[model samples]
Target: MLPKCIGNLSTTLTAFSSGGNRVFGEIPEEIGNFVNLEVLFMNLNQLSGVIPSNLGNLRNLARLDLSDNNMGGTIPSSLGNLTKLIGLSLSGNNFRGQIPSQLSNCRSLDSLDLSSNNLGGAIPPQLIGLSSFAIILDLSRNHLTGVLPKEVGNLRALTALDISDNLLVGEVPSSLGACIGLTSLRMGGNFFHGSIPQSIRLLGGIEELDISRNNLSGQIPEFLAVLHSLKILNLSYNKFEGMLPREGVFKNVTSTFIIGNNELCGGLPEFHLPDCISKSSKSKKINIVILSTCIIFGVLGVAVILAFIYLCWLKKKVNKPVPSLINSSCPNISYGELLKATDSFSSTNLIGVGSCGSVYKGILKDSGIAVAVKVFHLVHHGALKSFTVECEALKTIKHRNLLKILTVCSSIDYQGNDFKAIVYEFMDNGSLERWLHPSATSSHGNELPKKLNFIRRISIAIGVASALDYLHHQCHFPILHCDLKPSNILLDAKMVVHLGDFGLAKFLLGSSHDTVANQMSSMGLRGSVGYAPPEYAMGCEVSREGDVYSYGILLLEMFTGLSPTDNRFGDNLTLHSFVAAALPERVLEVTDRIPLLARASVWESLVPMKCLKNG
Candidate 1:
């Protein structure tokens, strides 16, 4: 909303020579006709529009600053014609374009900035001059590409250089090691490759350094790892390889430095890897070995030997157990007793696919107890990680409606092997999805239960919403359920809702970035397509609001018997909008018939863009 032109204002006063005068409003296009104007000082103004091309007529212009404006569009190419120009800054504006290479021809040009714009293209290579003493240079966040020219090393006077966030590639020029006077160097989030030049290792006066999120490879230069004066060093998400030399640098890192590479393994503190192999792969092999020993001994051992082992194992089994996703008995469980309880885990005893495992209804003969046993899948590492996270989270989760995790066995069989499983309080009724969208029912594949009535459906919806709200917002750390479909929600004997499946739950309390949910654009369109929000496509940093959006869609489906992702959203559409349109005279026509049989909210608080949102 800056003033369009100066002539539109009431003031036009030419000040006495050599006096400092303050002026307001935007520069007029006609002002370029100030033919004798040699010292233009419109540095900070609420100005709009590009500097007039006619301003290039100031043959003797020394200092020019049209900075801090609402200016849009390209910097005029004509400005470079000023042969006598000294200081130039079009900084901090909406102005965008490649730095005119012609300005470098101005031999006397010094101080430049075209930062924070949507400009694109490569930095000009031939622009560096030996005679010109350019001081400050900043060209960050533009779409500029290509390598930083080695000629820049010739700028012995250049104290600060920031070309961060551009598409520049290649190694940090070796000659940069000679720039001992450099106070700040920020080249983050680019494609610069190769190791940190060994020559730069001697930069004793350096204060800041950031080379994160780039393709830079090779071990971090050893000399840099020991620099005490350095305040910040971020080499995260790069291709840096090889075990860090433990005795020297990186020994006392205080700030965050992520070095997670697939090959850079086993050398860290948490990952106690053996010299024989990498940590992750070694853990997998150890698990395999433990599994083999348990199986071999189980088949050959006699009853006496088994009894001795069981009592001995019990002493070690009752302590806090290792985390697991599938709730099952301890690894050294009484296999024979469990087998007898399930009639040898018979097909008749099989229940459902519970999470990453198969569930079986078992009754202990000795105790006359009913329990559900979930067996781990043969090959599911994803299921394994999920199992571990859930075990940890559920250890603290104690809710009446939720399915309670009882215990899990983490030992090997008589053969001296390891198998994972968990035990949970069983539910007579399965998931809500089974009743609402029943395809098949019962382990015998019998007909699904009768369709739920309106009253029951609303109850289920309310329960589901409450569970979702708790998980999404009320938990100690807000847990984001990336997947929130009906099948994942279960009900108890009392018809109380208990949300299951934290396989995709992410703690959002202090997360700086949205993860897992972001890398889901492929695999036939991400996140169940219809349920995912629109902003997800733009990678706009998803929040708990996404879960809220999914819940709203579910509520809409509960009342309308139509999927929210259906093709009826905008054409006089949306369950909420459609229902609201039929208000006043006949709210009945707009009602979700299931709720018609029960007391409804009356939607007395409903309005446009209200709680019952469509988008």
Candidate 2:
């Protein structure tokens, strides 16, 4: 009794021609009586009982959906008799046991999502022939194991294929790269360890590639650097070694991206990691404290005062042994004329602020050259000595990564207020910290875009290190960047890095052995707490190792894509402590955000944090 057969047949009767009074119970096997039926859709009811094997009598049936009901037991083997069936969806019910492979003879399935169930065993490779031209394949989040067939490349028109979160292994078949139109590849978080094929990089149009958290080895092919169109690339926590690709997409990025893998090196100064110019140009701070006899030592406050005095001295000494912006005699612009051009110290034109004064983006009245004009704090009789020392030190030192102080402006305001200002080469990109976490400006989108990748991040680290190397070993006198942090390192138009804000501690102590250094061999106490070397905090002498610690923190930030103080880390976690926690094992726990997604897409689950700790 298949419902009521009297009202059930029409030539087009197909699946449900007659309502048959909507009796909610077991589908009667008698429905097989409809010999001319071409479609059957008896799903979503309280129907139960085995699908009658005799139902195959409907030779013309093209679609069958017996899903979402109380159906049970094995699929009727007679379903193989419906040679015309093109669509079959019996999912979401308590079907039991093995699927009869004989059904593959039907030869026409276009879309299938039979996931989220207990159906086990390897997907029969022969099923690829079932749909000669259909698309949309999804078999994710299941327990199915064994290697997927390389024969899948036969689906030349596949736009999207998701086979993630499974126990599948074996190399990602090179044949799949034949899908030239494929985009968004995720093959991370898996045990498919091997060098990636160059054919994948040959996919010129791919925008995002994640192959992190795996056992990949060998150098990242230089060819990958050619992916200029890529927006995010993740290859962290793998066994990649050697320097990063220094050309193509690797060359132009400025973000801190790579981390985890430790063998990577090279990337000399002026070397742009993949895309950034090398370590030769990235800025470094030199903290050389010269404790002086000055009173009112509120420490930070007095340091501020000392910085102000040296800045004044820095004016006359902008360039002595070092090259000056101009070779000619000092071009003096009267204070009155600069006052007028700056609109009487107007706040609107103000562009920056520093220890001793406010910086205004000003135009010189004499030559009309646009420059960043830093106006120091007011003139004081007692502070004049410290100011001169800064001017002189900045003048004698010369390096491409150091800021270029142009000239000074001095004059009296209408109220007889004494003013002094120094002009410098305008850094259009502002500070490194700002660029890394940029605030959107009116002209450019704010927020540092995910432009940095493994190669570029390494380049940035090396560049900063190189700068510090020069200060510690290459300079006439050793200098320590007492205040090293992301905020003070600056970036330029081409994403080249530069050092700014030279501290004046050595100046307040009056120069020479009286200063922090006795000459070129000075090992002084200078640096900020967060990035300061451990020994320095313990009252031991500072070393390049302190700068190295800061650089390490900076490196961790780039790789983890998290700040040193993010909640993701425990309370005692500095970037060092956090990274150390993830080290020797469990390193997969640290990843750039973009790569994490890629790893999950291309691999199994979040790589077991156990890999980091146990392996």
TM-score per candidate, in order? 0.46, 0.37
- Local accuracy of candidate 1 as per-residue lDDT tens digits, 501-613: 65545556352322222212221222345566768666665578888877876776666655655567766566556656777566666555555644334443344545545
Per-candidate Cα lDDT values, in order, are 0.60, 0.57
- Candidate 1: lDDT of 79? 80
Off by over 4 Å in 2: 1-329, 332-334, 337-350, 354-356, 378-389, 410-414, 439-454, 504-526, 534-543, 565-571, 584-588, 594-615
Candidate that would win on lDDT: 1
lDDT of 2 at 41: 77
